[model samples]
Target: GKGGAEAGAIGNISIYDVDFVPLLDAAGQPVDPNPVGHGLTEIDHLTHNVFRGRMKEWSEFYERFFNFREVRYFDIEGKLTGLKSKAMTSPCGKIRIPINESS
Candidate 1:
């Protein structure tokens, strides 16, 4: 799996599936139902770093396979570095992924 030690040795990012289980205390009782607090429900979005000049390719792939649509574009520049990003979201608006490329 991507989260295994072998994968970790090669890169910092690991892609894998997770099943959520209730948190428990020493007494085995479930911990706070809202562990994240502040009324946060679920992960709203995720970001991916893409190879420079491949943003268009990725955007097309997501749009073709996942029915995602490009919603926004961002260009952030700083003293030493800059990046380009495009945000895409699923048809239902529940999933959002922003692909980025650094300059």
Candidate 2:
């Protein structure tokens, strides 16, 4: 009952430690790394979409429950649509989630 529909679309949050197994050749040998690539180390941020009127509520929820503080606010306007967003980050600054709502 902890992370049921009460949590909305963000049902549950789980972090896992993943081991990356290298790509192997036909002979069971690891292939060489990409010459022009710098591999990804970790994720920096994520974005979540909410209903137009619920952005502030979700932002407050993240601040209260996850220790995420508001870092930035954006109001984007296009020719046909507009949106508002609030960026929230964890204390360590490694995680960020931007809550967006279309207007």
Best by TM-score: 1
By lDDT, the best candidate is 1
Which pairs in model 2 have colliding backbones?
none
The RMSD (Cα, Å) of candidate 1 is: 9.3
Candidate 1 per-residue C-alpha lDDT over 6-96 given as tens digits, one digit per residue, 9 for 90 to 100: 4322254443322235678999997786556467577889999998999999999999998999999999998999999999999999999
Writing each residue's lDDT as its tens digit, candidate 2 over 1-103 gives 2424243333344222112357788999987768456678789788999998999899999889989999999999999999999999999999999999998
Provide TM-scores for the models: 0.61, 0.61
Question: How many backbone clashes are present in model 1?
Answer: 0
Worst 10 residues of 2 by lDDT: 10-19
List candidate 1 segments past 4 Å from native.
1-41
Q: What are the candidates' C-alpha RMSDs?
A: 9.3, 12.3
Q: Give residue 67's lDDT in candidate 1 (0 to 100).
A: 94
Looking at candidate 1, the ten consecutive residues that score lowest on lDDT are 9-18
RMSD (CA, angstroms), candidate 2: 12.3
